[model samples]
Target chain A: MKYKDYYEILGVPRDADDDAIKKAYRKLAHKYHPDVSKDPAGEEKFKEIAEAYATLKDADKRAAYDRLGSHSPGQDFQPPPDWGTQYGEQDLRFEDIDLSDLLAGLAGGRQRGAGRRGTMAMPGEDYEVTARISLEDAYAGTLVDLNLSVPEYDANGRLHRVPRVFKARIPKGATHGQRLRLRGKGGKGFHGGRDGDLYLNIELVPHALFRPSGHDLYLDLPLAPWEAALGATVAVPTLAGTVHLKVPAGTAAGSKLRLSGRGLPTPHGKPGDLYAIAQIAVPPKLSEAERELFQKLAAGSTFDPRSHFNSEVKHGD
Target chain B: MATEPVEPAWLNDDARVSLDELAALSGLTDAALRELVDYGVLHPVDAAEAQWTFSARWVVVARTACRLRNDFELDLNALALTLSFLDRIRDLEAQLRSANAQLPRRHY
Candidate 1:
């Protein structure tokens, strides 16, 4: 097994006082603690820090660690003969235990499968991962697959990182930034400790036609000028199917038309409403007849769209 | 290959836990957990005299508290203050994420 230097992990000198070890531990813990840390590798670093602190803080464990002799970090070596007898762990091979478990023995927690004289029972690690589902999938329930490496004890009682694939369901009506916690879905527990949870952070992929806010959906409803002037039944697209929306007569631009219960589905409640913002779709190049008709209407009409602009308020030239 | 089935119940509000389960899972003592509730660091689903049940989400929060307590040797007051700040930071981060999603796509 590889040799780990606890003092080096905690960044303290060999003869450093107890208080110095503690202060160093606190600083590193604050920086790497999973709750406050934004670092991607924070959890693993924090665990190393905790294990180091656990061994060095106690006098007996520190003496045992010192007795293991000074070696370069990760150098492969075995404990001395007397060392095995002292902890009653003679039968287990070096491959069967971790350096953390060896020192955790001095800290007094039972390591799993180490028989009577074992180390600590630490809880499993919680994993947080992001799952990006398309807006269409968000409307209907969908499946997501995540790949993660979790710790596990082999048949010989050695810990190894096992790659695993987890499949989870993102329920309908799931919105961006929602956190879903799955119990016992994370890393395997150490010893007899409970398995940790898996947290899924949901992110909706951008859709070409729809904009989602929570469960609600927004889309631009383009209407021809004549269609806005005269009421018309227009085809509208929704997740389930296409439905006709009635455009009220004389509908103005920027009016939000509601399609009740036509948005994303919720797990347990009513689905959100969809809003279609009205946009006047004028023909970029009008035909000769169309231009003449528009010209005639302009000549016959006395309506002014700029009537709201008061005389005192300056208007752009 | 057959697809793995998911237990969606874990994500539901009904996935509540007792005080003992929370303590064992979080590596915090029963007394320490109560200190969290007393200081408003946590809000249990049911805070009755007969028993206190916390939402499953609190398990992670309690575990975070336990690690900070042991590593920093912090008293209850200090732990509570730090946790509250972390909570606010998490909320703000979530808000930022959603708000960013709504912004127009940047053309580069």
Candidate 2:
């Protein structure tokens, strides 16, 4: 029920050229395709990506969508009444030229029909479920038990609750709202056709120590002010465990330490590096003893960090 | 009173035919079994020239490979890679669990 920014979802700028949009969509589609991905929630994400590209890829539809301005697909959606009449009178048919049947693969086994129908067939129903993973479990990748709450209608026509337990694998680099599909896991197929897939959308809870990046891990390493200026050997956390890291001497603030082959491993066995970005922590309050020591140290040093500011200044002749 | 730890279901269960019996029963060629072994998904006890034995675990591994290839539509190389990672994760998890359990709990 949330409004998704199609351009942002496709990793494209709002003013991106049509060629750029197409290129981005194609590359992302190939990567997140359910058939190719081992991600537990890949199919639904593929559908969302397809839906985003479907509207944004067209010129007229993109214009209308842009004008709608931050509304969900069916939220108070009404087109201009005279617009269809104008097109009808102009002898122009908005045939399904823009929407190819290629999207059916993204929606999971939905087939194209023989008729010239304007709208696409109802997509296979998608089911949303949650998967929880520990930071290490997410980094190394592991199978998870997903408790799915499926709604079932009783003979009296009242909806009842039915819970199903499924085991799904969460691949490395999975992000929030990324979808995975289980074949024949959704509602029964219409007309005795194969059932739709069960879509698991990921929602990763916060970890006490580890954070996730795309095939990488992030963690905040608290460093002393002295450690930032005059470096020290520190123990840093990684997906495998904590490892000793060398903070190079004279390292400035915002410097990053790269620990090679210490992050999440890709399916192809290539691993990402752990990045330890430097953050100089300034104490909020200092005791009189500490303040005196700092004042003496400040007086002893003849260093001006902004010394280059005046040197770089250029005056008009 | 402290409660005893529960063992995993896989552990308490009977040592079903080690990968060797599975190979003899499955009638699959040695080449196919080698492929499964190379993927690191199936564990075999011994390897010899035309005399290697596989556990019944290979059947499950083979089925998983089949599902990954036929149903999920992954290529052989990708399927192999996915299974290899899954095995590595499982191994790491077991090690972590053992290490955590072995550490003495410090109660303040």
Candidate 3:
């Protein structure tokens, strides 16, 4: 069997502390993770880091690996004939075991069998939770404290809530349907496996004023009849702030005004536009004085709106 | 420096299409255009039984049909009925446009 050095791969001292090992694993994992890493050897480097982490993450597995001397142990490598009995039949399936099959299973069959530490279980379990943010918060992005209340049994076997607060930095272009993952924060290992990760599903709260239309926002602006007839610049509301919208002279009702770059910034990095459609509002039931003014205006006005109907009837006849 | 506007020879000209051009632009089969005519939404100028011809006005009907199908997820039958209502609205709009052209003169 080839000589595999777990300590050398993790860049840690022979007798490094547990906290130091965990910190090293996180740093190496982030550096080598295929999702974020651009190196040509990213996958291979990630496997090496995971292999080192699997062994060093747990006390018992680390001791067993230390005893084995071969990080990549082969079938030919033999400890004492009665190694299991000597270890008092320690459940190799303990939570800290870093076996490849178990990790692959927990990761939903993405990982292939590679890291083999006897029957030692992998460290950590994976968990899923949701993060709810406002649409505004999602638009601007935010750093928020996510509180997780996990139920566990104490030393006396009494059930209690284990409260944990993690500060998560949401990415700038995080959308409502996207997911974020926190590594090694899930259920504890059985014997000595690494704890799983926590998957965060983001939920965006609905907004009252802003309606999303393919990265663009849409708004219905109610305008007076005169404003629709004679175009007027009106103050309109947008996701960022209020802005004056130019209503072209002779603008009709239902005419849409576009404000470029006022829409949500999509994950693809392109910004959407905001569309404001104008609608004319008519006055309801007039008072006696208001009725007289309209009556006088109608009597004095020579504009007959229905006169075109007379020409159409003559042409049809 | 400000640039002067150019005038075209075809002033007050509207876009027009021959029967073949209409069929090419509309992308509908001959039978489909007949289906639109049968529904009374499209009225093509008829010369003879086999020599019937359509106009570019059918472009609006075809485009509205596409919008109903793709955007609003409406089926062909419902779209045909909606186009009938839209035809009535077009006739009313044409009447209004003609009426706006003639106004009594006023001396100020």
Candidate 4:
């Protein structure tokens, strides 16, 4: 029940003109706009600015707010008892704004519907929720169960959030950051108005074995030193199942081999390819005989891995 | 008794939302929407204002425009320009994300 100072929040003098107020608000709005701003507090700041602008922009609301003299932001002071009688409730219609007790008291505790008699009809506000699914589930369609707490207005016109559970089918090829809209599944409408739509923002959970890029999938394929040096057919794991991948002879570490049409399937266009990246693994320990064979091979071999390094270093200098 | 499972109604990008629905969802008055139309902010399905229908994505645009108008006291034309710029910025950011996602992973 804090008394918010609208003028102070907008950084404008109490006696500032409409044009000056508008200019200040615009500057702050641009700075704190949630879409454009990188600030983590931008959304909250934008809401505060919007609330301040909402009250100060209208002359009647400004006059009413100005009457409560010298009250600072966050310093709680109740409105005078005669406040409701003077405003007549009908003049105040702060649409969709949930005000504090002090501000709500000025409007006679009614947020909407000032002079209306019968049941007011207004469409419900749209609701958005994030839905996180596994990359595999996104690759292959799956039914997901979601538990959501939805706000409902009781008979006494008080709002309460009630939990509801439902199941939704995640269509195959659903990408990260995609939005799935469900019509008429949002907040309940007031009176006989239509309910709002529900939007589900999709987020793909990172897979342990696969990393998705666009529609394609990438996985690290581990190979022994001999297998990497000489070609071998290795079983690679895909979303569907394991398939044999042919690793060409002399495959170097970090080499990417593409397996066409083995990745996630899209609704339209061709399915994406899966890439197997070569990773060479060596034995940590060797027996005496193995060590002796390796030493003999090293003595006989004339291969120099760092032959180009000295030449490159000389050229750089 | 077990409750029936909820079946989601998937709406694509091409889905059209009615004017009344857009007005209710965006909290924008009909007059303000008309002004936005005059400024070429919204492209309706039809030419006539009374029978105007907006794309589903325009719902978000209209809501952003309403907030901008309320906070900044911007006229319809300025609001339209701002919304256009915002849209362009969003498109560029999405493109950047896609490009970054395609970059090869470096293993050190």
| DockQ winner | 1
User: Interface-residue RMSD per candidate?
Assistant: 5.3, 15.7, 25.9, 4.5
Cα lDDT, model 1, residue A31: 94
TM per candidate: 0.68, 0.42, 0.39, 0.68
Pairwise lDDT winner, candidates 2 and 3: 3
Report every candidate's CA lDDT: 0.77, 0.56, 0.57, 0.72
- Where does candidate 4 chain A have its weakest 10-residue lDDT segment? A109-118
DockQ of 4: 0.30
lDDT string, candidate 2, A1-317, tens digits: 23457887788988998889888877876677664566757777776777778777767557655653665533333334454343232222222112222222212212332122213433234354567666566666667766655543234322333566666666665543344445556543333344545545566676665454544545555677777778899988776777999997787655667788887665445676666666667767988988998899899999899999988998787
List model 4's recovered fraction of native interface contacts, to 2 decimals.
Answer: 0.34
Please compute DockQ, using alpha carbons, for every candidate against the native two-chain complex.
0.33, 0.03, 0.01, 0.30
- For model 3 the local lDDT of residue A167 reads 64
lDDT of 4 by residue, A1-317 (tens): 35687888899999998888778888998899876687869977987887777667767677777776658676756555555457764333333323432243344324443113326766676766678989888888887766766666656454545687656677886767666666677777777877876777778887777777667887888788778878999999899999999999999888989999988887556898998888887667988987897799799989898999977776643
Q: What lDDT score goes with residue A232 in model 3?
A: 87
Q: Which pairs in model 4 have colliding backbones?
A: none
Q: For each candidate, what is chain B's TM-score?
A: 0.84, 0.55, 0.57, 0.76
- State which docking tier applies to candidate 4: acceptable
Please state the Cα-based DockQ of model 2 relative to the true two-chain complex.
Answer: 0.03
Task: For model 4, state the Cα shift of residue A111 in Å.
Answer: 11
lDDT of 1 by residue, B1-98 (tens): 22374754333343678999889767799998898899998888867656998877787688778877876788989999999998899788767754
